[model samples]
Target: MKLNILSGLIAAALLVSGAARAATQLITEEEAKLPPPKGAVATDRRGILRGPKVEFVSPGDSVSSPMRLQLKFESFGGAKIDPESVKVIFLRTPNVDLTPRVKPFVQADGINMQDAELPPGDYTMRVDIKDSDGRPGTAIFTLKVAPK
Candidate 1:
């Protein structure tokens, strides 16, 4: 019994180590193609938005429950973004009518920040923004939260 347990532990360790190495390798490959500092465009299921580089900083690409998601974005266009037109809401749930728990605010530097605490569930967080000229764009970020 002791030998079997020892072998299982070793196998588990090896599996975990291999998975970590694979993840690290993927990150390095993605880092090479990261968008430029300025004039970056985010394109996802909701179409494309020129300029206004969007970056999801928190809750990471994937997260567990009881997580706080953070977003930071910049606008590089002719018209100023309408603060009232900024919204973050859930997607693909019929009759859910759920919106982000936290209200987003724009900093003086023209960057928009949104943070929200979420429960355990799969979420499609979609952010919509429109400029004063009524030019609109949407950014989609996927979140998976495991039950804690």
Candidate 2:
């Protein structure tokens, strides 16, 4: 029994360490390349607007409650878009244009959230992508964050 218990503990450790995990093809900002899905878009008084293709997948790309509304962006022409020039907004109020945001990461990809953390109710996610000159570009999407 002691040996069996020790063996189970060791297996759990390996799984959590990600050592036993196989290589995963990270969805690059480019491969995140899927045409933006539906969601909300808007601009704040500061004049920041979200891209048209902004979207979400899963928080951490896994199954869980209170799942995160991820954001996806793409620029096929004119000016190329990157993550830094983007922003996310989550709110409880409606019809009011506000700056939705998080700490913009230099190396962050699409947004995500587990299912449990987000409370059930009406919610909205907004995304904005900026041009090279630091002006808002043309892109937008909107979606309702509700019960799973």
Candidate 3:
């Protein structure tokens, strides 16, 4: 009887450890299946909790020198967003090398904004936003930068 109880305790401990690891694993955009056509904002709901709803705020399709861009994320389905977890990447841009750029400034209310003095050209950027619980959302937009 003692041996059986010891075996059962070991099994329970292993199960609990596995559950903890699963809960801390971060979910990626592809795994979450959150792509919503180009230039469209989308929310990911594949995780245990729903992600934020992303929206574009500034810098229309056409822009000029001293480009300023803004992306706003709101909690969807009562999810809490982690503003510091926001990230923006320059997917493609003419006459520019894709290097490590400065991180965008995140607001207290889940708004990430960046300002850059770019040359005359076109650019495409991707934004990734996530919640405090590891749920992620993504957005892609293009900018036609013209000479000011």
Candidate 4:
């Protein structure tokens, strides 16, 4: 009985350690080193329908890894934000689609990622969102991760 209990405790500890490692690997080193896309113009065109606005709420220009990432979303003209229409893209040569990884934390109000982990480097990201009326919106931001 004692041996069984000891093995169970060791397994549980290993699982917890694996989870922590996974949480800190949002972007891989190879992916982060890709070349920038050519003619990448981060512009948002406003049409008759107003688009949703995205604003970063924390970790100003530079921050360390394993930080909380908060973004606020606002919709205008009586239109509600469609959470399902949100897409996150890492602006690189072949834009890395981060939607799948971040879909769990996305909401109509905003995106609140509790533990966002990335390597020490400069990263650029683009967020695209649409309102219920199909009005599209885009926001581009940069995050500088300081070395540990």
Whose TM-score is greatest here?
A: 4
What TM-score does candidate 3 reach?
0.55
Summarize candidate 1's per-residue lDDT along 10-116 as a digit string, tens digits: 99999998854431110122322333234423444355445344466666655654455556655665666665666665543221223333343443123333223
Task: For residues 67-141, write the lDDT of model 4, one tens digit per residue.
Answer: 777889999989999999999888998889988888988998999887888889988888898899888888888
Local accuracy by lDDT, each model: 0.51, 0.42, 0.57, 0.84
10 residues in a row with least lDDT, candidate 2:
23-32
Off by over 4 Å in 4: 1-24, 46-49
Candidate ranking (TM-score, best to worst): 4, 3, 1, 2
Tens-digit per-residue lDDT, 94-124, candidate 3:
2122223434356635443344555566555
How well does candidate 2 match the true structure in TM-score terms?
Answer: 0.41
- After superposition of all CA atoms, the RMSD between model 4 and the true structure is 3.0
TM-score of each: 0.51, 0.41, 0.55, 0.82
lDDT of 2 at 142: 34
The total of clashing pairs for model 1 equals: 0
Superior by TM-score: candidate 2 or candidate 3: 3
Candidate 2 lDDT by residue in tens digits, 59-99:
43233233444455544335556556665443323332223
